[model samples]
Target: MITMSPASSNINSTDLDYYCTETPTVAIIWCVLGVLCACVGIPASVWLLWVLVQRQRSGTSNDIYVVNLTVMDLFYNVGTAPSMINYIAFRNHAFVLLDEILYSFSAIGRPLFMTCMCMDCFMAVVYPITYMKMKRYRYRLLSCAAVWGITPCIGTINAFIWYSPIPGALYWLLVPTIAICDLAILYTLRKPDPSGRSDVHPQKQRALQTITNSFVMTLVCYLPLMAMGPFLRLMPASDQVKFCVISLLVYIAPLLGGIIMPLLQLHSLGRLRGLLYCTRDSGSSEQPDQQL
Candidate 1:
């Protein structure tokens, strides 16, 4: 009679083989996309922030939310994009502390920023008149600062907990909570605008649509990784094939989302479209219109 330990019995030989042998085509794709994303996302995010800063001087509340989103995207691209490149090039090398730190920063920042964006949307929908009345620039600055300060602190604590012997219960809890919050924002938007406004402005509708798409994209990207966590925990020595599949699925979704978001925003926001055109027409001396 042959006896196998419970742990060995649970391990999938196929999963182990897959991870060891597969070339991680997904990672390669992610690397290419990551490089391209950095090239475009970084520059565009910076320019958007600059434009928002320019707008800020004139002092409008609406621009604050957009500016905050731009800053979030900027930081995300700057901090996270290089990690993808490193992972692709080095295959998860030991000397990737910078990549790890950037990855961790982004892991926290993305959700935090998304939550802030959702809150901004909720405020706009629920209190349109008040939202209009509020001095947006100060509120925007304060809100962004709070998010930046709070998320990193919480992330550091979570990282410590993660490294300890305790199970990663907090991560599981946080993921679901963030998902639920995003869903709530979508739900609130689905409700009729309380002002009995039958007609939605085209620009406003497009903005809302862009946000809705972004939320969906984020959920799609992260949910698989969340689901796979338990499987990984239970079968650490599982076969490489299953591991590769999960890794590819987990990474590709986010990479695709990161690529699509800026494009979606450009489609929705004419100002971004105009900026792109102006940049392309570098040598043209024609005066550009101030209004998007």
Candidate 2:
């Protein structure tokens, strides 16, 4: 069995005591949020997967990256939501290994997906001509495979290496990596369109805007968690505030990423709108309607 040292044990004790003695109102709020997240995230993620798979089959590249992003969000929601509910239900009891695994996967997967989406945006903006020339469906399939395959390995390694001895450094590294990649994506968006035109297709522009919004949403959700790490390590003994804050932020970040990001995309991307409302005589009616 994994054992805690005196200091670590004391820290855990203090944390539990804090939670037990703290305002019940805060706990109720967290529980309500947790339930709401699970209720909304679970079905939305499933729908996103169904929609993406159908679109993939029909070979629409217009929002393939968005589809991949939706899949990642699906994984996050499916993996994380129940665990959050359980944590709120159980209130700091020892979680099973399966819960640990799911929680770890969700934590790591959220950031990894954001990184992959940023990379996808970079590819779309920096290599527009190349992206247009290629067989986008095939490339998207390969890219999805790479993101799903590679992220678990990276997460596993990082978890083993950093969770115990060097939490701060690991978080520092992760934050910077996320920040840099996001900045690169932002820069890519700012560059002049190769066609030398001020205006682009509404669909294309919306797709890009969806990516931008997703990135911003991710950064906003995660910043608090990242900022909390140093404070957590430095003031490890603080009982009422630190643990509650950390737990709340950790849960909220993935909740927002999984639930909010896709909704943002659905609002921004007209393809989904078109697919959902095929009877409407919008600009979407002109295209050769692909299956789903």
Clashes of each: 10, 0
* Candidate 2 collision pairs: none
Model 2 global lDDT (CA atoms, 0 to 1): 0.55
Residue pairs clashing, model 1: 15-239, 15-240, 15-241, 16-238, 16-239, 16-240, 17-240, 18-240, 18-241, 19-240
- For 100-204, candidate 1 gives per-residue lDDT tens digits of 334433445555566566666666766788888987768778877886786456444433332321113434655566566556656656677689988876756
For model 2, residues 84-160, the per-residue Cα lDDT tens digits are 55544554434323444344344555565566566656667668887778776786678667756765565444334
What stretches of model 1 exceed 4 Å from their correct place? Answer: 1-24, 60-66, 79-85, 88-95, 127-142, 153-198, 202-207, 231-244, 272-292
| Model 1: worst 10 consecutive residues (lDDT sum) | 1-10
lDDT of each: 0.54, 0.55
Model 1 deviation from the true structure expressed as Cα RMSD, one decimal place:
8.8
Best by TM-score: 2
* Per-model TM-score on C-alpha atoms: 0.63, 0.68
Return the top candidate by lDDT: 2
- For candidate 2, the per-residue lDDT at 32 reads 64
